[model samples]
Target: MRLSQFFLPTLKENPAEAQIASHRLMLRAGMIRQQSAGIYTWLPLGLRVLRKVEAIVREEQNRAGVVELLMPTIQSADLWRESGRYDDYGKEMLRITDRHERELLYGPTNEEMLTDIVRTFVKSYKQLPLNLYHIQWKFRDEVRPRFGVMRGREFLMKDAYSFDLDEASARVSYNKQFLAYLRTYARLGLKAIPMKADTGPIGGDLSHEFIILAETGESQVFCDKDWLDLDVLDKAPKSAEELQSFVDWATGFYAATEEKHDPNAVPIPADRLHSARGIEVGHIFYFGEKYSKPMNATITLADGSTTPMHMGSYGVGVSRLLGAIIEASHDEAGIIWPEAVAPYHVGIITMKAGDAASDAKAQEIYAALTAKGIDVLYDDRDERAGVKFADLDLIGLPWQIIIGPRGLEKGVVEVKNRRTGQRDELSVTDALARVGA
Candidate 1:
């Protein structure tokens, strides 16, 4: 992508309404523009990052044996009524009415709808351990939607629904998602600790919320200090027993959101407890028959007896992760994107756009990187060198090649690592070889 032709409307100053680092940087970097309170339009650069996040979520979901499908944003009110939650869901549910006066709603979640679909088609235990998932947009009309996409009214989410014949089987599905979440966050360059959490409106007997530590988080978190050092992914548990053992080890540590915490309940000594603010990026629930019982979603057992299906729901805030990643990764200058989710892998900065040598060298480097299947952002704009450097740094690509007349005279170019702020002067061939571009 050429900066000169790209629709990246980066600003020199931050927007007045942005109150946090992620929000401010997103605005100044021209990644997104607010359309309304708690709502925004993701520009091209922002969409690239959002899509990358979605891809990771999808890959992990698939690895966990969750089948992907698309679900509609608007749902029939009858489904919610059958689940006995139409009125109970409260004001956050955006209720609507069609021209014919039939009630409708923009679904905040898909519990009732999934249950309805299962009840209509699934009839026997043979279809027992099915998991269906989708990546879609959701809306919850927050009373005060603030903090950019963190607390947005409209957002993208990856939601998975699991159906089992009984509670024991449902837990296996839950464990699968548990490991999947751990793997997902690890791939995205985050150490997400699974914390005991209140299920809230989801109404589940067992629930866990994945928390990523950040100073500018929305809620206070208390956890066993040991959690920071444990990598559940490293354990690589595959069998049911192994998976359960890993989950047990992870949850055995004392950890809870403020709402679920009790001072006397924690077994950890004060010296071992770590208290910090954290962002909730994903959540999972084993709601059993919360939706199935109310909606009569049932299946026949092996003995021919009929029973409501046991169900679990898992979710990752797809769009909200953009804010969470920025919160956990950015520095004073701009967002230092983790390599796994960076918008572009390599950047070619033309030090003097009008200079023939500099421009030609940048083009060569850009072509070399792109031909190697690396996403390269070419800064070919007719702008000052300082301005281009600042913009490139602000967007925070992982690798950069600085092509200038002076460096070309030395038979070398400058290569910089964005994260470490280290620069090396090397021959153009050496630089290309270092990056394998």
Candidate 2:
């Protein structure tokens, strides 16, 4: 993509309303724009990153044996009432009425809708152990929606529901999601610690929130220092018993959110304890029969008796992840995007766009990398070198190839690493091989 042809409306100054690093940088980088309070329109650059995040989430979910099926943003109010949670859900839920005066709502969550779907189609123990997932937009009427997409009223979410015939089998399904969340975060270049959590209105006895450490995080969290060295993807569980054991070992460390923290109850020694602020990017819950029982989502057992299916809910904050990533990975200049989620892998800055030599060299490098299946942002704008440098840093591509008139005359171009601020001058052929590699 060429910068001159791209619709990036980058601002030279920060927006006063942005309170955090991610919000300010996103605005200045022209990634997103506020459509209303707590709502945003994701610009082209932001959408590219978002879609990358979504793809990773989808791949991880599929690897965990969950099937995909999209659900509607608007759900019938009757489903909520049938689950005995209509009025109880409170003001956060946006209640609506169609022209026919039927009650409907923009779903804050899909527990009831999922239960209704399973009950209508699935029957008997043979259909048990099914896990279904979807990535969709959700809305909650937050009284005070601030901190940009971190706490937005409208956001994208990856939600999965698991159904099993009994509690024992349901646990195996729950464990799959538990491990999946950890692997997902790690793949996105995040170190996420799973901590015991309160289920809140979702109403589950067993719950875990996956938190990533960040100075600008909203929640205070405490954990064992060993978590810093722990590699969550070190081992993969292959059996039901192995899954249970892995989950037990993973949760064996002492970790809790501020609301659930109990200093005296911590099992780790004082020296091994580590406390820091964290942002929650994912959560998993095992609320057996919570919705199935109320909604009469029953299945026939092997003995021909009927019982409600044990169920669990797994969620990942798809849109909020951008804020969380920027919060955890940016410096004073701008966002330092992880390569896996970067909008583009490399950026080509043509120092003198109108210069014949400079333009030719930039196009050559850009075409070579693009042909190698790389996403390259070619800055062909007629702008100053300093301006181009600042924009490249602000956008945060992992690699940059700088083609200037002077360097072209020297038979080489400058290569830069955005995260390390490393720059080197090399032949054009060598530079392409390095960045493209």
Candidate 3:
């Protein structure tokens, strides 16, 4: 994409309201704009990153045997009433009313709606052990929404609901989601420790909150430092037994949110006990019949007995991840995007855009990169060399290719690694080869 044609309205000064580094950089980099207190309109650059994150989440979910299906943002309040949570879910729920006077709401979560849907069509044990997921917008009307998308009132979420015949089967389904979340965060270049958490409004005895440690985080977390080196991706899925082994290994670590922290519990050696602020990016819960029983989502068993299906809900904050990622990986210059979720793999900057030789060389490299199926954001705007370089750094593409009259005269272009701030001057072919294009 060409910068001149892109709708990036970058700002020179930070917005006073943005209190965190990710929020500040997002605004200054022209990734998003606030339309209201906690609502934002994602701009072109931000949307690209958001979709990339969503795609990773979707791919991992599919790999874990979860099918995808979108659910509506607005849901009838009747579903909540049927599940006996209408009165219990408090002011955080964004209640609304249609012109016809029917009760409606922007769903904060989909447990009630999904349960109602399952009860309507799924009968008997034949359709048991099903997982349905969606990527959709949700609203919670947080009383004091802050930290940009990290705590926004309106945000995008990847929510999956699983249904099974009994508690044992439900536990298996929960373990699948548990493993999936581990893989998902790893792919996005984040070390998200799954800590036992309190199930606030989404009542469940078994719950885990996947958190990324950040200085600006809202919650205090304790965990073993060894978790940082454990790699779930290297392990292969064998039987349910093997999968359970991996899950047990991950959960055996000493990790818990402040609410669940126990001083006398098995402690990490004092040197390895990590106490830090962390942001909760994903949460999973096995709620047994929390929604199913109340909503009559039951199936006839092989023994001819009818019983409510056990259910679980897993959630990843798709939008909030943009902020969490920045919080986890960034520097004083700007955001340092991970390669997997970067909007573009490379940023091609023509230091002297008006110079015929520099322009031609940049165009050639851009064409070659594009033909090789690379996502490159070309800075073709007529700006000073320093300005272009600063913008490229701010956007934080993994690699930067700098072309100028001087470099072109030497039959070379400068290639820079964003993460390492290392530069090398190589022939155009060598540069392209280095960038894998």
Candidate 4:
């Protein structure tokens, strides 16, 4: 993509309303625009990053054997009534009514609806152990929605529902999602620790909130420091047994959110107990038959008896992750995106945009990199050299190739690593090789 053609309205000064670094950078970088108090409109650059994050979540969900199917942003309130949560869900649920005077709502979560669907079609134990997921928009009426997308009222979420015949099988399904979440976050270059959490309105006894440590986080968390070194993707071709082992390895450490902490319990060694603020990126709940029983989602067993199917729900705050990642990975300059979810892998800056020699050289490099299937953002704007350099750094592309008139005369270009701040003047061919063209 060419910067001259892109609609990036970057600002020189931070917005006064943005209290957090991620929120400020997001607005100043022209990644998003506030539509209302908590609603936002994602710009082209922001959408690219959002889709990249969604792709990782989808891939990990697929790897865990969860099928994807999108549910609606608006759902009938009848389903909630069936599950006996129509009034219990409180103000967080955005209740509504349609033209015909029928009740509806922008679903905050989909437990009741998913169970209703299962009971309508699935009737036998043979079809048990099915996991379905969807990446869709959700609306929760937060009284104080701040921090940009981190606590937005309307956001994208990846919610997966799992069904099983019994508790044992349901536990396996839960472990599958647990492992998937670990891989998903790791792929996005985040060290998310699974801390025991209060289920809140989700109403589940067993729940874990995957949190990424950041000083500007909303919640305080306590955990052992060693969780930083655990890698979920290291073990390939994951199975239930392998997932159980990973769970055991992770749970062996002491980790708890404020809601789950016990003052009377044996304390973790003071030095080992790392207390920090963190953002909740994902959450998993193993609420067996919680919704199924209430919604009458029953399946027939081998003995010809019918019983409620055990179920679990797993959620990843897809949009919030954009902010959480920035909180975890940004520096003073701007966001340093993980390669897997970076909007563009490289930023090609034509320092002398109108100059024939510099333009030609940058175009050549851009063509070569694009041909090699690399996503390169070509800055062909007629801006000052310093401005171009600063813009490229602010966007935080992994690499920057500066084709200045001086460098072009020497048949060399300045290659800069955004993360490391390392610069090297190399021949065009050497630069291409270094950039994997």
Candidate achieving higher TM-score, 3 or 4 = 3
Residue pairs in clash, model 2: none
lDDT of model 3 at residue 433?
95
Each candidate structure's TM-score, on Cα atoms with residue i matched to residue i, is: 0.97, 0.98, 0.97, 0.96
Tens-digit lDDT string for candidate 3 (1-437): 88888887888787899999999999988999999999999999999999999999999999999999888999999999998889999999989999999999999999998888889889989888999999999999899999999899999999999999899999999999998998899999999898877788898799998999998887888889888766757774677778878788888888877777877774677777888999999999999988888788899988989999999999999999999999988888888999999989999988775999888888899999999999999999989989888888888899999998888888999999999999999999999998888
Candidate RMSDs in order? 1.4, 1.2, 1.3, 1.6
Single out the weakest 10-residue window by summed lDDT for candidate 1: 231-240
Model 4 TM-score relative to the real fold: 0.96
lDDT tens string, model 1, 1-437? 88788898999987889899899988888889999998899999999999999999999999989999999999999999988889999999999999999999999999999888889999999987999999999999999998899999999999999999889989989989999999999999998989877789888899999999999998999998888987667786857679888888778888887887888877999988899999999999999998999899999988989999999999999999999999998888788998889899888887886999898889888888888888889999888889988988888788889999999999999999888999999998899887666
Top candidate on lDDT is 2
Q: 1-437, model 4: which lDDT tens digit per residue?
A: 88889899988898999999899989988899999999999999999999999999999999889999888899999988888888998898899998999999999999988888878999999998899999999999999999999999999999999999989899889888888898899899898888777777788688888988998988788888766665556753355567677777676778887776775683667667788898899999998888999888999989999999999999999999999999988788888888888889999987765899888888899999999999999998888888887777777888889888888778789998888889999998999888777
lDDT of 2 by residue, 235-254 (tens): 65767668888999999988
Off by over 4 Å in 4: 235-238, 258-269
Error (Å) of candidate 1 at residue 250 is 1.4
